[model samples]
Target chain A: MFDLPDAAALPRLRPASSRPSLGLIGHGAFGAFIHPHLARFFDVVVHDPADSASASLASVAARQIVVLAVPLAQMRGVAVAIAPHLRPGALVVDVCSLKVAPLAILAEALPEHVEILGTHPLFGPQSGKAGIAGLRIALCPLRGRRARLAAQLLRRGFGLEVVQSTAEEHDRQMAYVQGLTHIVSRIVLAMDVPPLELRTTTFEHLTRMVDTVRHDSEALFRTIARDNPYAAEVRERFAAATAEVMERLGAP
Target chain B: MFDLPDAAALPRLRPASSRPSLGLIGHGAFGAFIHPHLARFFDVVVHDPADSASASLASVAARQIVVLAVPLAQMRGVAVAIAPHLRPGALVVDVCSLKVAPLAILAEALPEHVEILGTHPLFGPQSGKAGIAGLRIALCPLRGRRARLAAQLLRRGFGLEVVQSTAEEHDRQMAYVQGLTHIVSRIVLAMDVPPLELRTTTFEHLTRMVDTVRHDSEALFRTIARDNPYAAEVRERFAAATAEVMERLGAP
Candidate 1:
């Protein structure tokens, strides 16, 4: 169970420094993808328990902001372990795909003295071949006056489109949009037809999607599909649609 | 009730000249799109059934090639009506989305003396904006030596990739690739979300698809989705998948 902060009681932590020191909890593809851009705004410290120790991230821990870019399933444990080492009053936020689950986890794990916020970058690292010029970011405020400020930094400094929504609403919509789209793409890829056989514009479109999620970690897929309570419902709906269509085609 | 040539007995046709006179049987968006390009290959003639008569099509019937760029449902009827007027041994072809049905229609409707073939340009008029450089054209051979020649013109003259396949197989696969993709895209468009609310990368992808088909005529959509026998099966499978996902989401 998590102790969520009241909307009215959140803290406001804004520093006067030109560049904030930032600690990142995951160094996976998503972490590596956003780190360089984020480094322009904040001094970045990256920590991945699966890859590195707390001592490794200590050098960057002195920064003003801490960012958790870990898998949704591991977010809680990493937040708890890193909570003690974070600098006092450092604004902590996450870039997880699902908001509600991680928001709950971070709220429960972090100390009351620390500020917490959650964010979801709408575009995958693989999506931006050019750069993050027109990408969107969803910011879910948990317990901080710094939440809006942190979101503004992402928007103004980095040119990200920021949308504010509750963690629950974000998860509910994501279940339909992200989860179902990925599942459909996965099913298409699993069919394993040769590229030459796929000539239709529609097949080409589906191929783009399959390519998008092909590099994602299995853990990431599992977390998004299973950890989010709304995902199962979305997946089930897609499966039912597939089944009915197959039945009409006399397909098993 | 439609008479068609034996699939196994269909003969290929050869191109008549380096610059053949071309007759276009429809004057709608697709016909207009192809008209300018046809001018490069033949002395072009344009006819629209709603506006032009058989006598007008016959005025240009002296051309070596006649391209039926009309709607799929009207393709057979037009072919039969225009057959008696075409020059002997002239090559007649169609640009319909469905091959099997139209192939049969042309084979039965055209005079035995005139060469007939069915061609599906695996692209739209919008593709003309880039020129036909790397696009694909599917050739479904029906009668005469015109089929082989048509393939050559599509390749050597316009620089399109030519794919040869039976009309039945083409329609079967297109049901899944084209029909299902269009159906899903329409569903997304029908969701009626305001443009301001749709900011996600996934939604952007879906919107691109919706935009592609939005300008297409309802007859084209119906022909691709309903008239093509294989489409029902493919759409059924896709609809089933969507339903399955929706059911999981507990959508009523």
Candidate 2:
């Protein structure tokens, strides 16, 4: 049932039984997209309540590594649900767009015995439809030393560019990057501009940018526009700058 | 002093003496960038008041084909200046971002005996730096049948995609295409976003779009935003859409 055509070609140097056990807690778009890649290096057990193929939450959370790929709105509830079942020294990783809030929630909800790692893969099904190699992932070490090992594994094994950053720093930069992009995309999509035969290179670039973010979920857009603390300031700056541009253009 | 490395390799089946004489006004950025390409098919004589290397205005305007590449604000004055010198059978071509106003001015100022054609090469020095073979150029036949010959020559000789459209229809499409792009670029540039380490594919696309129009002249920006009749409506729609997005996100 898996759509991975490149699964057979993956290097199977180690046996499945000898690999570490990875517990995945969601079967949404991102969770499903990352399953096969994680399966190559770990024996994975999924625990999505909505999916019939998932294992029990207790059994999945007892693995050596637990990955929370649920939506940002559900991060706190899921973290609390898995806290009691996590084993000592287990690493808890989160793949969320905004790091500060989710990482804070994980730190307050999960047990101190378990290590916490905050990661933003920076790509999804649309961008990684072919393969995820050469893509970027931000690693934020929230509560332990395991983030370095995770960084090394992602860099060497998956051919990813790992950028080590703190939750605050990541959120600050994303305020402009993700925040501005989603805002512009949403506004342009709302404009509903008609298709035209005459287009310039700059207009094509704007169209491609809008197309990339058009398929993102409303929850994701909300997380990017509202969840990040610095996002409001960036949006304000953008609005003011837009007003200045309109004034300069003598817009009626 | 031209930066064109592909000049020598251009097809030269016909001798220079047999080619039609082309008078080019305004040795500005676009005029200079397009000079070599026109030089391949015609004997070019440039007339720029600011450039010492330019020929006299009378001498340049007397050629078989007179090309007006001046700024939109200066278009009426230049058209009036050349009206006395234009030959009866000569063809006049204008390369401007917005077609309707410039074409109207040319029709009003120039003699009816000379033909008029309006063209907008969608790429500039930055976008066409490598080569302009596959680039697009919008051709609006304003006054006469000479536009068809110009289209065939651009399509066959330079491998350009010539889109035949009327001046009004071209301006309507461009009000969204060029107008929105330049407006968004100006606003983003005014925002002064800092250098970000963590960037998504969509953010990169936005940055590249801004970069493409970042170096564009303010005159061009003004022409795209002010010269087109429908531009004000687009800006109003974009502003209203931005307000809706902000309201949906509960922007404080």
Candidate 3:
């Protein structure tokens, strides 16, 4: 039951209650950025694990929708804390960058009755600062009515293009997307700022790009590069391609 | 002599009469785009070798100023064809992407009496279509009064910022500027275009960048990579850093 319809449908299927009570669990940059938007259609309540322990998380499970907005490293702990309280028919979701890693934690930690969804909001606070009306969010349906709700909320309510994919396929796509950009950026920033005289628009634009992600936490960089199963192969391809280009230039 | 004059000297230097009759040696995209601008300030003649042969080369040497507008690969032959015809007083200039390589060819191939100036206009016809009033042009004075004249035309007339540097310094700087960008762009373009649903704004911008340089001739790519002496070292650094990042990502 997805919103994938035909000719007049042109795209997807399904229709459910558009607005559901959402229990958001995290208040980091991304979490806070999307809070106001989610609050529009959702009877929303946010829980920050750092502020107070199980008490805050307890408030989330009773709601119709529970979203885990914590970091990748903290997924298992978050899943465990909320699993007990999520009763039957309630949907749980996550908005992490990598899909497979966090979704797996949710499946292993949560009970069978708790329906689940995995999402990766492609833009962050900086990119979304202008408003994320036309942004992209990858949606992977795990179980129950919540997947349809995610598609509706992400597509209709917020105007995001909800790209439907499985957790494995999402991770595979991200290996080149999230994985390659970060790797290329990191490698470029590791060098000193090139002198002013030599700078061109292309180089200047690239430097500005590096500045945008300069504050990305080391933990996040390490996790993305290491966690996604497909990253290693993409990295090898990058290396081989780089070598070939250089060899074509006659580099020994 | 650089063009760093005080407040009263700001308006200009050397009267318009000091500008001599100009001869443009190629009429490709850049040459055509700039021909009208060059004509605005001086008596101008354009000779594209592809269109005409010895006669066009003959027309260039008699002019007070001769500019090589040919590609990097064609610089030596261009210089040779014009060498015997250039008068002792003429100033010769080249606007190749890699300044050192073509300037060296110009220096060796042309007669000693023909003064040389190495330059790189940092924008292309596409970028400059909106009028090139505020762009940058690197100026490396190799001989005579030609460099100052170039700085004047680019600055006071066309509003280009002329960064004074040596050919070696220019090449060293461009090793990262032109070298890294083309390499990064080429590598990114080598990957298949990701599906539309999965596209983010950043990815969209990167794809557009690939489009910008997509039509770059293979000879242009190879000449820039191989001819610039400092490019090999930069390529090596990029490779080493890429490997280190992939290793940190846990690649075998």
Model 2 DockQ reads 0.78
* Candidate 1 whole-model C-alpha lDDT, 0 to 1: 0.68
Clashing pairs for predicted structure model 3, backbone only: A2-A13, A3-A12, A3-A13, A4-A12, A4-A13, A5-A12, A6-A10
Looking at model 3, how many pairs of residues clash? 7
Models ranked on TM-score = 2, 3, 1
Candidate 2: tens digits of C-alpha lDDT, residues A109-192: 999898888999988887788899998999999987666667777887788999989899999999999998899989999999
Candidate 3 residue lDDT tens string, B1-252: 222223234455446555457889888877887888876666677788678543467877778788787889888888888899898878888989888788878888988876888888887775577788888889888877656756775787778888998888988988888787788777776655355456555555455555556777667677666678887888778778776766666643
Question: How much lDDT does candidate 3 score?
Answer: 0.75
Rank candidates by DockQ, best first: 2, 3, 1
Q: Per-residue error at B72 for model 3, in Å?
A: 3.4
lDDT of 1 by residue, B148-191 (tens): 65676677667788899888888877776677566655544444
Worst 10 residues of 2 chain B by lDDT: B1-10
Where is model 2 more than 4 Å wrong at Cα? A1-12, B1-12
Candidate 3, A87-193: lDDT as tens digits: 77777888888888888888899999878888888887766778989889999888766577558757876788888998888888787776666777788777654
Off by over 4 Å in 3: A1-21, A36-44, A52-55, A146-149, A155-157, B1-21, B32-44, B53-55, B107-115, B129-133, B146-149, B156-159, B191-196
lDDT of 2 by residue, B1-252 (tens): 011113243465667777788999989999999999999878899999898878999999998898998999999999999999998878889999989899989999999888888999999988888899999999998887666667777887788999989888999999999988888889889999999999888888899889889988988898898768998888889989999999999953
Cα TM-score per model: 0.75, 0.93, 0.82
- The true-versus-predicted C-alpha distance at residue B230 of model 3, in Å, is 1.9
What interface Cα RMSD is found for model 3? 2.3
Q: What shift in Å separates residue B83 of candidate 3 from its native position after superposition? A: 2.3
Candidate 1 residue-wise lDDT, A131-237, digit = tens: 98778888889996777666666666667888888888888777666775566554444444333542755446655666777777767666666667787775555
DockQ (model 3, Cα): 0.38
